[model samples]
Target: MGDQKGEVVGGLLDSVRDVAGLPECRGICKIMYGNLVRRIKLLSPLFEELKDGRQELGEEELKGLELLKRAFNSAKVVLISVNQGSKLYQAFHWDKVALKFHQVTEQIEEALSQVPYEKFDIPQEVREQIELVHAQFKRAKLKVETGDIQLMMDLNVAQIEGVDPAVLKRLSKKLQLMTINDQNKEGRAIHELAIASGNHGDKIFEMSSLLRKFKDCTHQDSLEFDSDEGERSPLKHRSPVIPDDFRCPISLELMKDPVIVSTGQTYERSSIQKWLAAGHHTCPKTQQTLLQTTLTPNYVLKSLITLWCDSNGVELPKKQGSCQSKKPGRESGAVDCDRTAIDVLLKKLADGKPDQQRAAAGELRLLAKRNADNRICIADAGAIPLLVELLSSSDPRTQEHAVTALLNLSINESNKGKIVNAGAIPDIVDVLKKGSMEARENAAATLFSLSVIDENKVAIGAAGAIPALVSLLDEGSPRGKKDAATAIFNLSIYQGNKARAIKAGIIGPVMGLLRDAGGGMVDEALAILAILANHAEGKAAIGLARPIPILVEVARTGSPRNRENAASVLWSLCSGDLEQLKEAREIGAEDILKELLECGTDRAKRKAGTLLELFQRLDAPSPSSLEQKSDA
Candidate 1:
């Protein structure tokens, strides 16, 4: 009989742990079940107290354990139900879920009250914890959270009254559903709930209606947004992408009347007005509280947008609520405009005179830098071949503009392949070696951007860009050195390029930067060394530079990220190299390791802990010494 009671208590403890291990509920469901989860987790330690002493329990205590087990089983059901339910459904039907919480709380409280502590072998701490949990459940049973009730009422009103934006702003804040990512998560939950409910209910209908209204007020509509002209124009296929800066951050549509808010972020006048009317006292784009809510007209951006529209043949959007606005799909004029502009520039590069080529290259550079869409447009217009041709032009300024344009265009991921396939690496390398300083800086930067593609790392290395990059790092201007450091860091990520970089004499410049405390390149230098330290030859070169004291100083005093990277580099240096480990210990790295173990970033703390353990292990007597001590 005692054995059976022990087995029962052990099984109940397992059940309690399982309930405590369930994932906590989220959003409105979290508000309802959060306290209940806490209560169940508190009971885990209480059950643990009974695991070894289960045989000492009498029948009455066994009955109490059984009662608590039943209550915990009930809790597990409720937790699973809420975690799997739709956030929207939970928000709308919060009262029904709250009832489940109230009932489960009462059941658990009653079951805990029956556990006679004096009759059992449980500790005083476990008894007190269970009692505290019982009292909490007792209070929770009668407590009605007025705020949760109000939130539920707001959600219902939104479902019935077509979503007042002011109420929506309040709901969004209360529910933590502010970002687009949050809305998408709720949408997925709603879809899952609809599928589970077989899609035929008033509740699903209400949820769908509320979500639709919420999205319509928040997200951008299609190109036909506010325009009433519904005709499908033939030019719909050629509608140009609007520049992101010209569009309202709120509505994501072209701003007819741009206004600057207190935060200096610009938005369309109507969109800002609607946001203010919705009782939002903060900027939509920045979320900063408004100082005065004054809308100052941004004449400069308005003029630039107007000039762009005029040059691209795109129609300017009309004032809010005005008739005769630009028709949707018919305003594909910008598309045609960009195509024409790019073709004319390409033609100038191919056959125009020297001045025309330089001017055209400069224009293409600005166009590529303006926005992502323009980068695509410029590259799609077949400008890479012409630009590569100009990389070696005898005219220095034209070469500068040409390489810089390629640099800007390479910001788009797809254009990396295009630039490489156009046979630009050798020309870019040539410019890096011999062009004017600014041109060489940009050429190095261009190589860095292109080398982001892993395959280009090898090609750029084979084309001898590493030597030129090393030279720039050693002798170029401040900006040039930074660019070269970044390019070398990226190229050296490949196994083959690490050797090439070492052969090109990268260690001297890197060591110089490390030793120069005021050079502002310590971060970049240490970052590159951290990567290079993993390679054998590169590691040997860095080791010969005698980097322990400097690295220890950095680990002791650098900024958080710098300290983290310094720790990483130190660990790489000392991991398999006993001489390096002894050198670090001798140079006072042990005290810094202890400091880092306490206050460093997570990765830094981990590396510091491993190094500290290694140091301790080294300090401990060996097995042979221990045996000798025993003999003595």
Candidate 2:
């Protein structure tokens, strides 16, 4: 029976070993489940204490224990099956279980390597318990495989159990070193990879190209900025090159219409001349710089001289060659030096002081010449009434100079009426009424100068001056008649003087001069006829007084100039009454029309045609009268 029981035990052990050697059995269950539960009964006390205390395991620990319990239960079932006397199942069961025990030991080592000892506080008692479990598992693994119970007893479970603190510290330092070393390795690997691929060279080339483009753009931008800055600078700082002294002093602009001053100095430009001539030689406020001897003739002054000479029908002097000189101041007195001496003496008479005035006047009378400025100077000196008083001088020379100066002074229309009102006209008329032919001619010329003013025309007409003027037109010299006819023409231009001319019986002398057809009296006659035609009452009086018939006769038989002037007068008369149209046409005005057509301007032709048409329209019978004549 002892022999039989040993065999049974051996068989049971063999079966348990076979089941534990399966490939899936691991951890404590693979190594120690048979011995701890059945052979040694080592887990009995732990199971009893856990049941009594109701000790709870952590979730991770419980998961590990549950895996162990499942493995043990699977081993138990496989052991039972092997013990059912299946030889093939029992054949490699011990080797298989031994390999599984080694696998479980490796798993335990791997689990301990990964476990965080920092999260747990294991007591000594628990540590010892775990050590006993490890020892039991290791001993059972050896005994089942080799059938060596003694080797099972030699197993050092404590060595396989919990970690030593020193070992744990070494592991922590190793892990930290590994982590830092990994970071350094990664950095070195990336740098080497960049160099190997030529990517770093490409980045350098791209940066260099970008820098060159940026420099070019900046250079262009700087040039544009400088150009704009220059454009924005001010223009006032740029100086004009005109000379300062060239500017005018009076207008402060440029010089125009300059004149000459007669003090004692000269200037380069004419501004000073104008200033001095206007009585501004010394500035009105500053009173400096006496401007004189400057010659700047204005364009208007030159134009006035040309017009005066042309209108007077006088010939200007030709340019003379330089005279061959005799020795200074030595001359034969036989040459008639009157012309040169007269010019010099006239200048002195015009501008000389009062002491030299009479000597200059005597020289002017000897040459029968006068200067216009002498009259201006005398008038400026308030000597006009004195000159008028001298008109009655017994000396013909004094009377001639006085009348010439008065005539020149009265050339201005304002001064003409003034002199006439100052009781000069009656004196002037007495000369024309009674003096010698030379006196009459001078008086007539003076009256002609005065008659240009409208007020003088009326005044002289009222003073009974026209009859004396007309008497000269018949009996006086050609110059006297010219002057007298001019006076008559001027007086006749006025409506008031037209009646005065007729009442003074001066129109008869004017017509007599026109009848002579000499001495250029035609213009004066046509002018008187025009003035008469313009006045309605004057036209009627002229027609009743027989002047109209004389005008009609001139229009019929006179020269073309006379006929044109007569037709113009008739046109003016026609404006007053259409009845003048018949009288004008009856005087052979159709000949005037034919003459106008042959020679007249377009305007004159049109005007004459219109007048002829008006005359014909008036001559035709009226429509109402024609109806009455047809009934008769």
Candidate 3:
């Protein structure tokens, strides 16, 4: 309300100041985010409109907008950089933090490359406004570029008191003898001040407070020095922190079966294996071809990591193998996918040579993919374990074929138990986490089918399936999104998994899909939302997703199930809440619901009738319903 348009850039710089001052402690990055995300949120619509309407603007204005666009994009990259580092810091790694910084700077450079500055023809009043905003923006940019990191090792506080030249030299030597571990924030601040002011034993708390306000620091992940004990003190309460370089760049995970590449970069063997197996022969960092195709075992790094984990009593991540070839299976002519052919493929997959196994897996994959009867045929042939074994193969193509075949096979209720019993959950989770996009979709869909078995639900949750599925809903191909939503819908049937699904940020994407999605996906997404909306968290998340109008539109015009689901979801959200009922009225939802009540099935008719009765009772039009009206 207070000059939002005028304060856009100014607000950005102020937000940066607040964000930069936040401590680089675990969970603090979450606090540092929303500022930039909010700025981008405000500017996005304005930027889009300007870009789409250059014909309505003068060339100079268009140019100004372009420069502003570059600035905004650069800020977004910086935000992403901070976001990546936040995730890294939460794990207590600093090397990746440095790498994230380098990558963000590169992105910023690319973002601003198209900035036009030659003879800009903006008016003086507008130009004055820009210069005024630019002054603070430039300073903030400079501060970020030349970040203020005062590492305690480099801080020479002994000479800061304006002490004497000769006797003070001896004094400095003696002062340096009283050492503090730089990693101890309180101790470092105490040392800095005692060396500077020369007489304050009680100043540790005061200085630590100041340091927290003025600086962002990496707190030791699990270890800290006991401040009173001077010599090699161990933390009384905390565990030991891992070394910064222990994680693979590709996976951002701890190295297991560490391997050094031709580029002299060490990665978790499985990560680099997956990379190489995905068909990129070049180094991920240097882009140089690994002509020799060798990965030397980094035994020293592995030993050190092992020693650290052993000393700290921390369990290491599971050791996983490298990836396989990415080449897809050849689509052959239609096969007579009867019971005999299915048995032949299953035997070959189970007992044939590697080449024969791969071919059989691919053919079974194709047969399963062809139709439901073939899936039943393959299931009847007892192919679950063979297909599950192929899922663990190094060849990505083999893994994809195996997982997809398992998914197709899992469509049969009898095959699901066999799939789960054959130890398919972990391997399926692995594919969901790291497979090709297509493989990931198949894995998600397969997990949904397998989870239908009551026993397998716990296994899927334990295997960490929710986030991976949510990611697909957030950003995936159309088919992938549909499957991911269906997966969430299936998984949410268990009460414990609902909180996990909602916490993974599922509501927003599912609602976003509802805005444009079609067919069974809309039905699937709504079914999930209906359950989510029953809980307080679900209702709040649905309100935040802002899809009531879209739901209203769907209620007015969609398939029977969609109309019923939409009407029911709206009725759930509005029931026992007058404000929500008022919103329903304002969005033309009353009219839609009346129409739905008159024309819809019994379930939709009942919900619409109830929603309308509530709206008629409440006179206040809700804010969301007003927005929905304008939106519709």
Candidate 4:
């Protein structure tokens, strides 16, 4: 029992010695044996006493060792007294202040470092706040590192708490001095982060995109608002008015190719002027303002009137006021002479001077050829009868010019019967048989124009014009041959004249002219042959004489125009006679017919097809024979 008590007493002594050695207090102490020792003067002694079976310590015995252990273990109670005592010591000594601050900084850093960085999913606003906080923390850290205590103090605790760990690490120096306001901390942080990341420019671009979106949104809103307003909005309620017959009522499309009518209204050319003049210009459906302008006669109407006057052999209005000024100058004179030549010509005509009359008439004929209007005026002024009389003259030039002038006057179909009645055809034919190339060509052209009318064709054919034209084909000039061929072609278009042409022995010469110097003559001759081939008398004449060789040559080696005409002739021949089918096939007509059928004009193709069909039908075997062969 004494040994255990002694052991407990020794343990209590060691605990008291350990507590006394702790540096809980600061003081001057003796340096004994190179070790500084604090002098802790004990005011009480150790003693032994009994109280409720607990031992009481006696004076000067160091009996409070167990109580010291208990107090030290109860740090909350003992730390308050220690802090109070340290504050009192610190008031008297500034050296301990630095050490206290160092300890405080170490504690704060350790606590901040322990904060969990990865625990929370940061909202955008919270993330921004953290960025701002980090920026502030960096600034504060920089200032604190440079020993700017005032700046460090200015930084708030909230700023440090809000700082994102990543941002805090990135800009630790700037973040160190920043203050965070709880109210606007997130916004400020976002702004700071945006500035640091150079996203401010991107924000401006985003603002522009937002403005555009706003504009589109506003437009849509306005439309909806307008629609909601219903009829109150004029723009929403009103529709553009258009006419029922909005078309030009002329062209029936929009108003183009406009012309005026006598009813004082503008309409497109497709509108009938006469119908408009008769008060039919307005739209049948809508009586809106379809009138575009005031009316005037179209130029074509005047042209048609002029054409009518010229065609009927009527004289145009003479330039009366100043004949000399209005008359073409001597340099522009077609006759290569003056009015003196006319006087001389009139004298020769009166005196019956054949050679002189012929020369003067030839001059007039040359002038007339140069001016068609002059020829018409001369004919209308009764020069035609005088020229017809000159056709009986012995001089060929006299007869030639006389016939030429007469031919010019006879161009009008209305004048054709009259010219024939006046014995003009025989005179013209006589001159054509002996006339110069120019005279013959002019005669042929005039005859051709006249032959367009069926009455003129009969009159001319009756007056023996076919033989004279055919004679010109044999001995005429290139132009003469062409004109003669053309006239013959025109004559053949009339079935009555076709028989007459054949009876006049004109068919052979007309076919011969197909190989003439002029390509036009060849085309015209082929055309005449084609026309003749359509008539029974003409076909009989062609079949007996057979112009097929000439036509075949033209088809094979002629110009496209010639080939076309040749094809037309072949078509007419095949249409008139099935016997010509074998002949056509023998001439390699099948291949040529196919080419024309595919590539020729519509008319040519139609004719070629007809010919091909005719050939096929003619070549087809009898059904009775086929049936018999099948039965066998």
Candidate 5:
């Protein structure tokens, strides 16, 4: 217990210096950090005094030391998190950050109160200073600054108004997101934060999405916000409050093709389609048990919606099929033609026997594949979990169709979250391990789609998917190898998953794919290797695989992307290792690198340039040799 207390005191002192040394912050963080650093500095002398008297302290003082350690640690985390997070994220989440400050300050004051400072033989000035600081902290109230609120409002306005240059320019400058380069740096930072956050929640993902909008806005070459083909308006950002009667209850957008369920509740065709497809036997609005699954078209509601749109200047939701001659631009009522048929198929999926289930799954797979809107309709109807459940069916054909349907549905960004949240990773991994070749291949593809979201990477890796993916990479058919390679590459982006991939024995198959140039997985294999090389364990494993000669060869002769990756992997291996550098020199890689300096892509050239400099250092005379020469 004494040793632990000493360690905590030592850590707290170091953290104090770290917080003090941090650069000046802007906005809400500036105020919070200023107050915190000032208060924590007052504890420095108190902490030093404790270190000297720790052996003589009583039990109450020791408990107070533990509480002090926790308070300081919480302060350090809050300060660092605000300093390191995306500046825009800090501004937008000012309320949360302010609450953190309040909580951390209260914690410090409470810890101070518990400590019997008078018992220790501390200097009179220091003790009074500590007490005064504690009193100030106890009285301090953290409030969200008006500037931060305006900054958040500006961000929302820019997002809603479709890339207002003035708004973006002002907000970007304020948020320090001025250039495309700055945006990229913040993007990488957010990705790191997301991985570090683990399964904490959606906050990091929201930061990523907000940053993406800033990138899009800044990347535009012109001032005009194109609403038709470029920078299309998001539905939520539209200014008008859609009438309650005109909006679909499930989707809350203007109902293009409104239909009434048995409980007399109206919904957009796609929304209702999604709800029914999910196998719900009750009305979504009232939760009343559905008497029958029949959907009656509300033509009067549709006419009213059209009149409202005309009066309000809001365009009605467009149709998705072949244009009708009578309406000129409007789609023929092909969706109406399929509505009854889809209703029957959804019933078969929910209540039909095994044969019917198999047939229905196959058709839904085709429908989801045919159009993006159909995918939305299917997913919103809650078909994703049903499809995930079918992945475990005893019938082989049913399992194949079910997994394939999920793979198709996973293409939609919203459906990706739904699929993952529905507890699909373990089942998908099971399918990848034991299902038929096609099912396994589609399962791999589905995993890739789901892993597109950063948080899903952690969940998928934890579900024991890496080993099965490696097995597929080693033995599956050509298409299967490609799918597995993509999923593995994406999953390995998170740091933990990178180590998992290495431990799963991925190096052997990756080397095999690299050597078999005609196997058509060279691009995929190289991409995965580049990501894995970023990890320390992965670097050691790839180095032991004796890949220097192959990497050098690819850097010399492969396609642009492959050459870039080869250079990256080589640099990672040879950066600090003298043995790898010596091997590269002996393999005659110098001449190829010099040629790359003149003709390669920007990134490839950068990596090649770095390697050449390392080679120069390898040949450069050491300081000791220079000293010996002077003596001679």
Candidate 6:
């Protein structure tokens, strides 16, 4: 028993540091060794009997030895868990952690193989505990291997797909994957093993409490905060009551990483991240199930809190949330931070299985939305093609998520070329025709962003996206209409695209928008009509539709920008065309133009003068025509 204690049990505890280069696990080794040494010191006069050539242990000694071995072995299991978990602070090393899990499980299985309880007739309860540890290990290993596959089966909504090799290579850089379920399971298994060991179970590791030790531990990258009063420093003084809006409902403390879930409830980013990381698909406060996990940073709320802190002398929350870019004007550090993270997420989005890909899509969308820099990094990492591929996915929800991501990326002007080169226009066009209403709206919005480039405008125009755009303007929701109008305005900048837009019959519907459009939509709708009216085909459509009355009213009452657009379209219609002049006169445009000329700015007055001058020239009768009318 003494030799077993010195060699096998001691060897197991010492091997932990050697097996992994984790600095976090080093402290636990000392605690495990101390526990072993204290247990060993309880025995006395053992060496004297062994030196006298006593061949076997007495009954009491043998039972004590079995108990000691079990204690050391159980302590070894706890140390292994601490080893695994301390490195699990960030998801960046999950692959490494997974390998460690395999090795540690193998190590425990080997150690458990040494306990010859059946041959030695150890106590039944102790034997049962050891058996229980083995069973728990098996259960944990099984869970790690199969959890992902099961999750995929549960969430997979379409046939398996094969990704393009070139696209895959572009995005296949290994990144830290988020693996909450597996990590939580591993922690649980070790905690259960420690409990079954009878004595070692109550000891807590450094940050996470095993069932008894790690209760209510909050983990951050490279740091952990203990919520328990006994675990933390003694409270010196109570602070002021934090504003209810400032506090996260999940943590009920100050929101450090303040993020808003789909339900519009705000929680600390870390708390919500853990909730999502644990694969729960509902809000903690409302219990309303979430369809998509998009945690937008509540930057306004954060700003208010910062201002409140400065004004009241209360402490500001730590700058832990991804959105709270603490250092402004330091572009290099921000870009460097974003580049590595975007690479990791892109890799996961490109190469991971269905559930992982979906999760990565949702996460990438959220991150890209946080700031312009993140979007630039995501686009530069060749995320465009992978997102384009996801856009073609058969799953409706996946399609919307992919569309949302593409829309986010397309906001960066540089990503347009990548998306266009990948021929995303075709898929996006398909989405406009067939996707869900939200997907359709997002697709149209993406098209608006993409068509801002002159080259992409021609490409989208060639892809026959104009008809779908026109249809959206006619029948889509309010936001969809605005997006479509913006896209048409961008597309109609070129003369050929104008012809294409006119061919799609955009003039009448666009005029309908001009009549009642509010907010930014008013300007965009007016611009499309003005561009269309410059062409002969479009002028006839607008003249026949007879929106001159609406134009006259808008030129008089709309915002300055809208008035300018309205005046320009009217100028195109009325200049040198007697028929258009007649339409303008019948709609009382002359009087409105006269009023605008008196009160309008230089641009509006210039346009009104041009219209009024054309009306004067068209109204003047020729001398020969007047003489002929007098003779008759």
TM-score-better candidate, 1 vs 2: 1
Model 2 stretches astray by more than 4 angstroms: 1-370, 394-397, 409-422, 544-563, 572-587, 594-610, 629-632
Give lDDT: candidate 2, residue 511.
61
Better candidate by TM-score, 2 or 4: 4
If scored against the real structure, what TM-score would every candidate get? 0.49, 0.40, 0.43, 0.43, 0.49, 0.47
Task: Put down candidate 6 lDDT per residue, 1-632, tens digits, no spaces.
Answer: 65644443344334333333333332222333233333223221232223334344445544444444444444444445444432212122334444554555555454445444354334456556556655554444422334323323322221123323232222111111123343344354443222211111112121122111111111221132223444463442334445668765544456776888887889877666645542234466544446478989888998998988887788877677444575454554656446776778788878887756876787787666544568667776778889889887777877887888887776555676788888799999889888888888888888877775667888888888888889898988887887787777767877788888888888768767766655435666776787788888888777777777788888878876567778988898777677777977887888888988998756678999989988887778999999999999
lDDT of each: 0.78, 0.49, 0.60, 0.50, 0.78, 0.61
lDDT of each residue in 109-202, candidate 5, tens digit only = 8998898888877888889988888889888887766667667788678656366667877777777886767777676565433322222234
1-632 per-residue lDDT for model 1 (tens digits): 57757666777777767766777555565655777877777877766777766447777887887788778767777777676545677777777777888788889888888877666677788888777877877777545577777787788677666556888767765665665666666665664343222212346556655665565555433334433335554333334556768866555557899999987899888767645542334566544346578999999999999998898789887765563354343235443338788999999999999978997998898787655568777887899999999999999989999999998888766788899999999999999999999999999988987886778989999999999999999989888898898889879879999999999889989999988989888878997898898898988999999999999999999987678778888888888888999999998999999999999877789989988887888799999999999999
TM-score of 3: 0.43
The TM-score obtained by model 1 is 0.49
Writing each residue's lDDT as its tens digit, candidate 3 over 367-484 gives: 7654545766677667887787787787777888889888767655567788888889998988988888888999988887777666787779878899899998877787787778
Per-prediction CA RMSD (Å):
31.2, 66.6, 33.5, 53.4, 32.0, 22.5
State the weakest 10-residue window (summed lDDT) of model 4: 28-37
How many steric clashes between backbone atoms does each model show? 0, 2, 3, 30, 3, 3
The order by descending TM-score is 1, 5, 6, 4, 3, 2
Off by over 4 Å in 5: 1-337
Position 439, candidate 6: lDDT: 89
Instruction: Give candidate 3's total backbone clashes.
Output: 3
In candidate 6, which residue pairs get closer than 3 Å at backbone N, Cα or C atoms, i.e. clash?
A: 209-213, 209-214, 257-269
State the local distance difference test value for candidate 6.
Answer: 0.61
